[model samples]
Target: MNTRCLVVCLAICAGPTFAQHIDIDPRKDVANLTGEQIYTQVCQGCHMPDAKGAVGAGRYPPLAGDVKLASGAYPAVMVMNGRGNMPAFGPMFTDAQIADVINYVRTHFGNAYTDSLEPDDVKVFRPPPPSNPPEKH
Candidate 1:
């Protein structure tokens, strides 16, 4: 096959595959998702399928057997506020979802912490919205 034809064929074949794997949907409501569902659909993208995390341009900390998860509040705050390179999910996720996911991670992925976070607990960690709107420049 000619080079142009080969490129066209490859693009056609790969298009559907690429589209199928594009799981991140910012507009989709995830409020109803369970902890495991949240982790699989969202967190696994960075943390890896095994929850061992990854390192390349930036480091994604391993959630497996993490000591920080021992304190439910710590992870709850981190998820709400974010730290370092991690993006804040506070605006996107509901308190319930955050609590559920944190609880899930705490129990699974080599972690055995029995203490689970409640949605009310997560509410305390969320930063209050700005009282005044910023003026447009």
Candidate 2:
């Protein structure tokens, strides 16, 4: 990596997205965990163990083998859109964690799969968080 590119990449990845809405799993990608484990650890409470992740009347849509997240369009939509009750994990989880969770969901849930959700991939999805309050320093 050259200095200029290094600087650019550094500028892009200098800091992690700081947000109050996302929850990143310390463990890399939920895929490393069992289906039930992923549920109890990160999803169960909201989506439920049955994959019927419905929070209520259209709150959390079921993430069963129904949602077409594994499409060519990119799973970032499901994560970034904050669609319905689905919150974006771009900031909360480390890139690895995001990849893990996404891989888990893509294989276990996304019916018609196309790709694997990598951490490097998730990193790109995070379009800077709403400008942070001016630094105190």
Best by lDDT: 1
Residues 66-126, candidate 1, lDDT per residue (tens digit)? 9989999999988898887666778767899999999999999999999879999999998
Alpha-carbon TM-score of each model against the true structure: 0.75, 0.54
The TM-score between candidate 2 and the true structure equals 0.54
Residue 129 lDDT in model 2? 68
Q: Please tell me which predicted candidate would have the highest TM-score against the true structure.
A: 1
Query: Which regions of candidate 1 deviate over 4 angstroms?
Result: 1-28, 133-137
Encode model 2's per-residue lDDT on 1-137: one tens digit a residue. 22332332233334334211233323333325543454455555566666565544445556678555645236555554456445454554456655665566666654546577665676676676678788797
**Could you tell me how far off, in angstroms, the CA of residue 7 lies in candidate 2 after the best superposition?**
39
Backbone clashes, each candidate: 0, 6
Question: lDDT at 76 for candidate 2?
Answer: 57
Residue 131 local lDDT, model 2: 80
Clashing residue pairs, backbone N/CA/C < 3 A, model 1: none
> What C-alpha lDDT do the candidate models reach, one value each?
0.76, 0.51
Among all windows of ten consecutive residues in candidate 1, which has the lowest summed lDDT?
1-10
